[model samples]
Target: MKPMRSIILVVLLTLGLFMLSSCTRTDAPSESHSIAPSQSTDNTNDTPSATARISFVSAGNEAGFYSVEEYDGHGIVAYIDYATQTQLPLCGRPECRHSDSSCTAYALVENMSIPVLAVINDKLVIMQTEVGSDTLPHISIADLDGSNPQLLCELDSNISISPQLYTDGANLYALATVYSGSGSHLELYRFSLKDGSYESLCSFADGVNGMITSCFDMSLTLMFTRIDEESGSVEDYAQVFHVDTNTLDDPVISLTGVSEEAYTIYNSTLITLDTKDALTATMTFTDLRTGSSVEYKTNALLSASGMNSATLNVFDLWDGWYRITLNGDGKFASFNVNPVTGEFFPMTLYYEDSMNVVLIFAESGNNLLVRAGWDETRDGTTLTNLKPIYALISKDDYLHSVPNYTYIEGLDL
Candidate 1:
């Protein structure tokens, strides 16, 4: 856990470590997955816990969810109490303090092994390994609360499960990365838990790098970017790849098609910016959930409005937002785009001749996770680097242009 600090992002971002497979459950989308990111509606009454308050609170599922607690260079996992909303170690041993490796909660962390916390469907599935425990990482079966654990199956590689996982009922989509001189991509090893024997299928994805949202059944919405082999420049904007997650049935890989450096698949719609004409552009998005054909009328609308180009940047937020950069006098002017209503929101980072530029990390519930960075300068010399802090704010507050931020203390990792 100390040297293997690279996986801290995966551990903390669980929001809660339950990647529920899209099984025969009739739950809403909110209750179907685990994730984290957000900003300043931080409750002032939040009593300080010994562990870090997970930036993204996972309140979707009520059966209790798992997350990480990285304290004093030591990484440990904990489960949030459903009633009291307090963080507690996974160890259930009577009279046993959880400070040492003897506790089940700290054993894996103390051994310095990579542990992936996930609950595939209704059962708790923890892929972990201890120093003297086993040679290879094994998937274990345990109760929903992770009691009386038994071996499930040994993973061929070391246990390094990504916080984000996708599944379709019987299969657990594990994460992997493709490396080359060109770039890396987000890869998935679809391991089956119940479709007969132990088998895996690599979900096909074509991109230099990618981030998957969820495996809504057999489909995944990926925000990826491809490197330009000719120009050698990474594309200016992100591209969306919505493809079949399981290629077991059909050997042929089915790609919905890549957009012009900019695309987004949100809600049930998959939209790509059509930039064939330099004078104007059009965006026609199809609802993959319904599989309906979308016609072209947005291009005509852009042409009628006399716009310059179709190149845009899509921000994969809670819903969807885009930004269009226009050539300004000295700096590039970026404006946020509203796809549905075709409205634009200018992004001016300064007011009253002062500035406080902020970075948005994630959106959780009605809150946003943002960090404001600024430097103090006096007597012609810069005083410090970017002094910033993680905070939470209501999405409604941000939408209404309120700048009040509730700074959280322990979100720096």
Candidate 2:
């Protein structure tokens, strides 16, 4: 009986090999448009796995001419396209303003074949997917000449659709959720374009199971954290972890200090600042080779008079610098912190009244994109009177304006 089963297995394997060989063809698409036979090569070394460039686009709204209404509710995707500037719409429409409740409700167009937009060799490529579906996820690949988008691949099952997309040169990564027994589980997956394959790099379970609030991918390593809610306390804890994809079996190496609320990791440094209370903490480099931790702390309250406010706002952190907005007695002020030296300095950026402001930090090539905005501004002259406007900070210290009244388009791929 065992011999018979082995023979049957061998027969099945032979038939499968035959079918796979017959399906293989040499007419696959190439980077060029010529009708040449596809050359067989190892796809593993096809593209470098690093961020060649970074791009930004706004959520689809009416003001932008080339705006895409697909990203109405979801966060905007940054694609790099140098041929022509594309516009993305903002969240609310004039008539449907009150109807939209959350940013997640916007209809999004998914393309998995070719990247919607990409930066290859410093050239921006814009390609759209030929296969259209509201249910299935696909991508389209093309160059910057508005060429026809080539179908790359289609994901059919057990996949969480991500509206937030980013790429590290060769492969693209996105935040997706998988179906567990009780609820969904959040995870990050790496998708390869050359082989049309994907693998889960990280995951977090439900409940106090360390949910990912944000991530930053630099070089071959990924620096991210899990935001876990305390069992009884209102405060949350952020556990930072660094993963190197090169070692798939053992990626995670070091962990950082836990925080009560928001934190940012950059250049191997961790910054945690609490808004409601005047408290800030910083962690030095956590050497993976040796388990060692270095930490620094400071009182959130800067001035003796400003300590009375119950609520504050921490904005941006890059390299070792931090930006924070403080509000008290109906007044506001912005301060910068040097995490290395624990020095705090005031900045001219501030908002008046009590409007909420959001800061978006993005890196484009050697440039750093910083966008700041408030609900309303008080006349717009004094730091106290002016509302937050999006500011673009370049590597050369050049600042550009992300106009509230204009449209911006592009992708990171």
Give candidate 1 regions above 4 Å deviation.
Answer: 1-65, 79-99, 108-114, 119-124, 128-137, 141-146, 158-163, 175-188, 192-197, 202-214, 221-268, 274-284, 289-312, 319-337, 343-393, 398-413
- 63-92 per-residue lDDT for model 2 (tens digits): 111112223233332221111223222222
Output the lDDT of residue 49, model 1. Answer: 25
lDDT of 2 at 169: 47
Clashes of each: 11, 25
CA lDDT for candidate 2: 0.35
- Model 1 lDDT at residue 304: 36
Evaluate all candidate structures by whole-model CA lDDT and list the values in order. Answer: 0.42, 0.35
lDDT of 1 at 158: 32
